[model samples]
Target: MTPRIHGGTDALGPARWDFSSNANACGPCPLALQAVQQADATRYPDPSYTRLRAALADLHGVEAARVLPAASASEAIQRLTAWRARAGDRRVWTPPHAYGDYAHAASAWGLERVAGPALAQLVWLCDPGSPLGQGESGAAVQAALEGDARTGVLDCAYAPLRLRGASALDPAQRDCVWQLWSPNKALGLTGVRAAYAIAPRGSEAAVAALQALAPSWPIGAHGQALLLAWAQPAVQDWVAASRTTLAAWAQDLRALLARHGWACAPSDTAFGCARPPRPLDATALRARGVKLRDATSFGLQGWWRLSAQQPPALAALDEALQEQEREAVR
Candidate 1:
């Protein structure tokens, strides 16, 4: 199978200005950072993850039984897909532009992609979606919720980092679908791998099924620490404050790209897609200590996903793009 592509730090090492991964530009939150730093790696975490599960459950106002832990959001996707496949689900549906892992996991489990949610046995939804960073349509979400699909998971990875707009799903609707959260992004601790899911109301059987498929000790010491920090009131407060900074940075980045004749797509979150006046040489950019996510992997050819960053990073990008333009004109 072909390797899946992702953003953030990559094989080329970190970039000077990385508009690739959509982690909160204003994070890693100090509180969460301190928690991870202090996590003791000498012992195994509680195998049952009782305390961690309870903390996540309390954060979502759900019962502990409804909270399912995973090594990361990507692992959650794969495990959930594997469980659904084992349960006889043979088809999946996904948004037009979504995180690639959804399709990758589905394909790994022999699930074929169908054009619509109504026709698939499993469906994936990303609110304030990846690449585009836009909210999914209400009609589509309703269709997925009310459809005959055996399972539906809404990736809320970017929800806490949303710079504008409310979730498309109401509380009632939200209760009907699985909600997956990866706090590493919100805490600006993407290096830490940890995520959890709130199974839909009355999904005890499904949760149990997924648990059976998961390996023992899905989360590690540091992962546990990061998640516990994520549930704290002070950490959440920091996340909320970070959004204001991100909103301003996103605006500045968008304006900067627009000035360079890039077509910026509308987004409700801290990142979005933009198409430059000319094709970008990703390798060349990387060599210049700048990197951008090629949107082709997210199903958008000739477009790029740009994550909001501080002014210094944005300025570096500006210089890089200018240099590229100068060379192209030569």
Candidate 2:
């Protein structure tokens, strides 16, 4: 298995000022948290996920048959790659800089990574993408949708957390591909491992095949409760309101990094990549309770991916940077 590198809690426990993960800083949404905590752990959710599928389908305004739930976004990636490989798909295309899970899944299924979307049997796209938080190019989406034979999966993981700009794929275009959504991050409950995908229009057989390959009860009761709560208007409202706060924090974060001499990259979501004025002592920073996501895994070396934090966390980061500078001078 390809080694997995991710953000959030580590061996030392969660960071005091964690800019490493893109989860909504204002979340663990109260409403969602209540639902999860009250979940009926004694009973099993419908193995077929009838009600859950319908809820997700209704949320997206799609048919119930189109909804396919998974353990998480990474789980969905692996399952899709396996399905494509089983159908003799030999090539996969992913954004130049994207979630490592895409490439790892392709490698596991023995699918060759192609240079362009048109040359591949499977294509992956992310909007308000991770690390950089940029939207996928329109041309890439078009290429993925050009052929009926090709399978396209658009990662909508960061869509709810988007702080600026609109999606590259509009409603009609999104219906043309698999829309993979993991709402945990937006709900501020990333600990809940649940995700679902909306299959492209008229891809029932493909959906069924992937579903058959899945193990029983891909999501547990707590996950089911979380997904159910995600469809609630109150929860949606909370998420929307949080975005306003997050946007302001993102702006403040950019300014903070700029003041410290770091060059930040533009991002539509709350998280973005930035280059420190000088090499950072990451271990030292961690020891001081600060953690940042290195962008090297996303193929961007010398840049760190950071998410907007609350003022207190931001202040802590400022202190950490100043300390680093003082140490360098000494």
Highest TM-score model number: 2
Model 1 segments more than 4 A misplaced:
147-149
Model 2, range 35-146, lDDT digits (tens) per residue? 9999999999999999999888888889999999999999999999999899889999999989999999998989999999999999999997888999999889999989
Cα displacement (Å) at residue 233, model 2? 1.0
Residue by residue across 118-182, what tens digits does model 1's lDDT show? 78778788887898989988866877788545577899999998877889898888899999999
Sequence-dependent TM-score of model 2:
0.98
TM-score to true structure, per model: 0.98, 0.98
Specify the poorest-scoring 10-residue window by lDDT in model 1: 142-151
